[model samples]
Target chain A: MSKLDQFESVFKAASKERFHYSPQELHSILVVTDLPEHEAKLYTDRIRDYLPLDGENITWATLTGEEFDDIGGLFEGIEKYRPDLICTYRNLKSQGWQWPYSLGEYLDVLTQATTTPVLVYPHPEKKEALEKLGQLKNVMAVTDHLAGDDRLVNFAISVTPKDGTLYLSHIEDKRTFDRYIEVIGKIPALDTDVAKTTITQQLLKEPRDYIQSCRDVLAQHESSPKIEEVVQMGTHLDEYKRLIEEHQINLLVLNTKDADQLAMHGLAYPLAVELKDIPMLML
Target chain B: MSWFTWFASSPTSVPASLAASQPHAHHAVSLGVTLFFLVLLILMILSLALEEKLHAKKSVIVGVFAVVSLLLADIFGLLPLSQAGRFFVENPLHEKIEMPVYIPAIDWGVVAIILGSSVFVDVTSRSGLFSWIAIKLTKASNGDPKKLLTYYGVMTVLFSAVLNNVTAMIIVGSLTVVSLEKLERREKLLGFLLIEGLLTNIGGLLTLISSVPNIIVGNAAKISFAKFFIVACPYVAVATALTIWMGAKLFKIEGLTNEKEMAAANEKVQSFDENDGIESNGFFWFATTMTGLFVGTLATASFLPYIKDLGMGYVALGFALIMLIRYKSEADKFYQAVDWDLLAFFAGLFVVIHVMEHAQVLALIGKGLSVIVKLGPTLGSGLVLISASAFSSVTDNIPLAAMLAKILGNMNTPSSSGLWWSVIFGANLGGNLTPIGSASTLVAVTIIHKHGLKLSFGEFVVKALPFALLQIALATVYVLLFLR
Candidate 1:
């Protein structure tokens, strides 16, 4: 109500949330799979070829099917190795992958209960799993809110080959956006058109700004992979599936943990379940 | 007169003249029966208070009490033998007259107002109007902690006045979380939320329909909607400002000390889009216009012809109907969203209170209250205000307000009496004393816990005691100086 208050309000209206990028270090990789020792070693070698963790001192460990039985055993194996990164396929020790409704109990609990970043490759039984992992040429990092996710973006960048392209994509869930907008529409004080446009712009703006910052930072490096931005508002699963197919993306990266709940991130579970033939890096 | 002689006289409807002539006249029920019913009433209140701990719904607790009261009233020959089940009593003339029963005991007017208002507010909330205003206010604070505290506090009051306290708290409390989180000032969240929660009770005193206690007390005193608002607005304004100031001082919520910090704070809030919540332009405009009309109609109901006789409840219901017509095909959805549990609780509560009246329990309470009144209007009113506030701080204020209003009414207290204002102020402001005192404050505590903040009950009481005491003291002075 005062002039000072008025000044502060106007100043706040002109300000925005800024994004900062931080690089991620991948020092150790642990590959877990439900295969015999020889076959597990073979799979680990194939993963080593695709992931661009080239540091000479970087450590690698393999946990075969015979090494662990249940969730507890898998956790014990992971505790023993304590790697910065865990690479595995969906439906780890279960036959649920044969039916396509869930990410299997092992992947579900592993994604949510642990702090270590997980790289979920397609179930090895899928016909296209090996073909999709042949080259990490197109690595796409997807999330509902992409701003300020420096670790996810950095991880995506680290995995992509220098000659490959990296896509930073953010899709605002249309259902959620509409639900909130519908609430606004019922309010008598707001102008509906203004709310719709401004909110849509603001939602898209954060991720775009963050992606631009990514571009700005990567521009300084001569050998950095090419960075591309894909931002849209749509139903997440359908839009993501379409984007992955359209880009012919080799590796998908997304966040799997929810800060508020013990369950896997709402979007990640479905994306992990439905995209059975593509390699995914779940953070 | 003999029982046959009294019963042979035509049973006529109780006249208003009888109330004026024998204001404190009560049935000659046995002291044992009266004490028994009194204990039952206390048990009901205790059960209602421990609703959460017992894990039983409030409606169920009150509903069981209502039925038990009726059965006991019937067993003790307190209930009339007439098929109508009216409360029959002999007047000074020894002529039998019938007092209205069960259905009339539940003030449909109060129930109507709550139901209608709930429907109307719920429907309008879907339009994102509250969210938009909240976002705009957040931006207006420029993300300054002190400024944010002030804006959110005032907004909480205004929302509580128009909407229910719980809705007001949720809308503002949630925005506080998001806004503070964005500014990277989560450390101030507990303070902001706690302050906003306390302010809701202060705001609830603004209008006649703002809270259940206000509605119960205001209706009993026959305070017109406009008069209720005019009388309480000044006190609410002062209390709100004082509470906000106290919260800011106690919580150390301060403005940016340096230019660079201020600029950064300003920048962070700019990202908040006020219009982000709106979806439909037509519905938004319609809801806004209707809300204005609804408030105007309620405030002017007594002055308007035809509506004056129908009372404010019809005005609320009429407006609710108009709004419901917008989504006629899906009207059931809004209806389903209504707080039926609250309505059922009120219904059962009123029935129990009605039986208490028949059993002469109210007259007993009135006898005690009369001693306080004899202390002289100023001192008496002040004592009443403080006492009601203290009682309300620890229990459900609705039943307290209802019982006190009935006692005052039995004592033939005038409509303009300061006693009515005392009850109003005490019933509304008392909730600030503890988290469990009111639904709104409890919600605030829940939000705090949900955000991973630790706020113990003793800690909340210690923090809130000063604000509650100051507000009650202010109300006492206001009643003595003006309303008395």
Candidate 2:
């Protein structure tokens, strides 16, 4: 991805993190220090991907509280709202390590001040949110590196478990198997059934087929993930709602690579339209 | 420390579990891991090749030593411990390759000892520790060479107890020269004197933090800072004294006074900022306040597992800031003089070390050393010093110190020794193994460079080798005699 695209992804992911909480709590109750309001919103939005908000009493603090006095204002703010969890985006600066606050005083302020839980979130703390998103377990590469019809095998491995029947789909094209194989070395084995489909073909993509394909791949290696494939109706927002209703997919994994929706139109639209309660693990 | 240990998990119990049960086991080594190890190895070769004064053979040995580290990491999967999460990356196979584990329980304290002594030279020299001593002796002698360096070794021993050897040498050496210059017209032995001072600094660190590796070990072991200082003081004292005696024998000074020239050069300049003068406010107060802050933090850290919560940094920083604010203009000069780049270097080191910690390759090496030592302070200390001294030849010593300090927090070390001592020993002594090892050596060189003089690598080693050996021996004797 381009550098700008990478930044866009990070921002998109960050925003999903905070989208679930009440905007007022985010805007007024929490004062983020160095993260700024913009970054805080981004973080929330990113988290919204994996952890869909049930609209509970969750308070997200974006500031790095390095000093005892720095927390005093927030302490009182927290007391009034009495939020369930107070999480700070902690890095080197937020520890409040200025002198008079002796480590003792700093500890006292954090633990003694409130009954609410204080959780410090280091950068990239939510590492495993979507590690298990793909059914094959091993996160496969998106590179169309193969030449001529061999991509079907690649798709099989990509979509099926190392020990199961392969289920494959593309947004635009519908072929029995993908073209190209020379670039990918030799294919693993040709026993599993590999087919082509898309998010539009919801009724055809059965969960049993996905599980069987995954099992085929797993015979080669004992530790492969159980694969499941569900078709979303379209790449765009309106289609995702229809797809979610029809497919009833367990999780939605979107790569920022193909989508062309500028700004939030691409993400926020689909996120808003899709079933908000189902866990969507976006990288 | 307690919170972090709890967060880190037991070394023996690998964090990774069957893919079906535990979701958190994906934390393992990535591309970043391979890259850091490569950089460290490349630098080790470069620094040794570039400078002849350092032990070249040892550098090669260390380069091999670094390579051995990989076997102990995640991909190799030699260590049975598996607390780390799995790592995923694309390989040639259609399926994504799923192999990412950090080395189990990497310890950086070994590196602490490697560069400890060398860095001490720079710190002590810059701290004005040696300058103060040199000036006192210089004034007392009226330029008599014999009387000037009579107790050079003794002074080194005593000073090493407080500061590392490098600082002691610079403080003592510089003043000695100043005094010598007082009684003479033409100065010829400035080069020899500075070299000797540099050597003395290396030799004096009998204490753990006084050297790089010792600090690494002490910190890895989770020993207290104060207790380390108290225990290692005598060893430092003896090593320092031995350094001085050896120094005097290596470079003897003899000259007659030029009465007319001496009087003219000795003329004093009047000061404009009267308040800024040393006599204006007692050094005792500054020393006491700094000491109090240092002692307070250490005492608190020893007792409180959640010390970070207590604003320890803020408290110490508060005092420092207050003093800075109160004496703003005055302190600014010193602030300007302070080695800020070194601090930046230190900050970068923490990030690098943190990356290593997350990778876990370092901890694998630590486990190996743990087996050799069987939980004794000596072998643990030996490993810390050797590693620190070896690696520090390439990297900055402070970050090396900090990394070791953090790792020592997670190792199987003796609590009685206090973590700080290992930090002191490895950092201070290990620094001595190279010319870039300590601050005093740098200061001494810069001072010489300022006046248009330079010492070749071979020259430095010749002057420093025996003295360095002597200091380490003296320190070993002291530790054996008292610390144990």
Candidate 3:
């Protein structure tokens, strides 16, 4: 079964909220993609792990570096998928692509026959970290694509007119498989804030162990920003607006997921549309 | 006889002197009331004078004077003690008199606008330049007298509406004579334009701001800027049409000159079309903005009582300050054109009327008129119009218009619409009757004198008075018929 077959209800729920944001028809198939393939395959079963199972048509595709060498073929491949969405990881080399210029060729190909809604969900780690910080916990900043581990750059930033010191706690929440199952129960009632804080508090229940994970991640840091642990919730768009305004966040990072599965399901897919004004990058 | 008087109460021929000696309190009450009213009146005057810079100065002076005066009078017991005060309080004597009632403050808007517009027109209507042009245009026609008179009448009517009619008449009067110098028929053109001023107050009627009393009515009624124009534009059009129609009959000239003379004059007028002294009315935008601001402030004043929203008296200061800043060079020139004497005249007249109001003389007059009308507004409106017309011929329209405006106030009645309309009609049209009737009439008479064209009071009455009377009658009829 395709990844799109796993989660069709997430897209339908979003579509119900606003017809303008929804696909043109109720039966529109969402085509999903996970790109810049890594050595370890992302759990393809994760698509089916959540979201409702009915009233959707979706397909999933995974792409690698050489496949993108021919731009025309890549664009043709996008249309051939007949996607309601095209979720893919960003290339680490350049800044995120701007609309029209960024998605124009693929969109142009879609317009030739099929015009689909493309959604991308970066890993939700940064959003979860920002939400955790708002809940009166340790603060963290996403390093720029160019910023190496010299942490003095953002130290001068202050919320008020006067300057103040900014310290990073490198707080990490490491969840075991058994705990994540229990977390799904709390997830039903908790909002983005509740969901995020609960996860942080759970990891910090044994504060020494959580700090050790943070130390290891920081110690092994490359020039590229490490992905923060992602927390999923029922509503992503509202959570996104509040986080951006409150935190003055300017960029969102995502992981490539099957776009067809996303257009048919989770906030991970719609994250691209919600954060359109800001830069979104896929890890 | 004394013993018998004590027993028999002096046989009742009259009450005993002791019986009458029990004092009546009416005098004491009247005395105290009159004095109390005097103090309040004084305080109000002081308040107004200090309102431009309203502060503790007026309050301190008024407070001290009030406390001291009351204390001093109390010490003397002239403040009406006991039965004396009670006597007058129980049975008051009412004094009444006949006075015209009208809508208030709107007259000042008229005066401000007329004066402002007049200053503008005066600066625009070039006497020397218009004269030069007129002469040149008339020369080719060998200076035909009738064509010159025709041009003079047209310009006079046009300017009269814009400026005070008399000033327009004068400016046009001078140029007409200049234009007719070659034809040697300057008197006839001068006379025609002079007469035209007597008839048409078209400009005055066109807008609430154009005339003194219309503004007074507009403000008193709290009419909106947009609504005033809507209501008044038709009346003005009808009035102008009626005046023109009647004026044509009155000014019907006999025995027209041939085309040869007309052609020569047309060529002469064409010849003097130079641009000297005819600036492009450069302040049109400023004038328009100020006019809108003025109208807006007045319309919104009822909703907002802050000094800024009240009227031009407060708002004009700001406009003046801006003018001083932007056009500092022309400040003096503009000041010269202001007619501050007219402003002073208005102020002095305000004080005089205030004095009368303090005396309750005007109130007495109002009460007497209320008796005949039974205070019913429709009849009151007619009586007021007749009286305003009569008085306006004696004094300048400003004071009379103001006095009538205050008396009428904001009377609430079904007929008040007519009454309001009547006040404007009476005050504006009444200004047309005699040389003393309006600032404009005097202005025209003065300029006619300058042109070597003599128009005596008696002569003007014989020639122009009938047409002027007809115009006022038409206005009165308009008020009674349509306004109601």
lDDT tens per residue, model 3, B146-214:
444444444555444444454554455445444455344554554555555664454465555555555
In the range B251-339, model 2's lDDT, one tens digit per residue, is 65543367763444333111011121122234435544554554456446556666534423333344445445435566544455443
Candidate 3 lDDT tens digits, A105-215? 343233233334333333322344323322111122222111122211122111111111122222232333336646765776656555557555434333233223343
Question: lDDT for every model?
Answer: 0.83, 0.41, 0.44
Residues forming the 10-long window of minimal summed lDDT in candidate 3 chain B = B1-10
Best by DockQ: 1
State each candidate's chain A TM-score: 0.91, 0.26, 0.29
Candidate 3 wrongly placed segments (more than 4 Å): A1-283, B1-167, B182-184, B200-202, B224-228, B254-257, B279-326, B375-379, B410-416
Query: TM-score-based ranking, best first?
Result: 1, 3, 2
Interface RMSD over true interface Cα atoms for each candidate: 10.2, 26.6, 40.8
DockQ of each: 0.08, 0.00, 0.00
**Candidate 2 Cα errors over 4 Å, as ranges:** A1-283, B1-137, B150-177, B185-220, B254-316, B329-337, B371-395, B398-409, B417-426, B477-484
lDDT tens per residue, model 1, B1-484: 1111122113564453553345335346988889999999999989977888999888899999999998898788665345455445464575665554465568788998999999998788767677778888877887788998999999999999998898888778877877787789999989998999999999999999999998998888889889999999999999999999999899999888898888888877866766545568788789889989988999999889988877878888888888888788999988888888889999999999978987888878888889999999999999999999888888889999999988887777899999999998998888889888898998899889978999998999999999899999999999999999
Q: Residues A1-283, candidate 1: write the lDDT tens digits.
A: 1212322332333233344445677788899999999989988888888777757879999999999999999999999999998999888888888998888788888888888889888777775667556767899998988887887888888788889999999999899889998999999998889899988987897788778768887887778899999999999889988988899898898988888988888888888888888888898
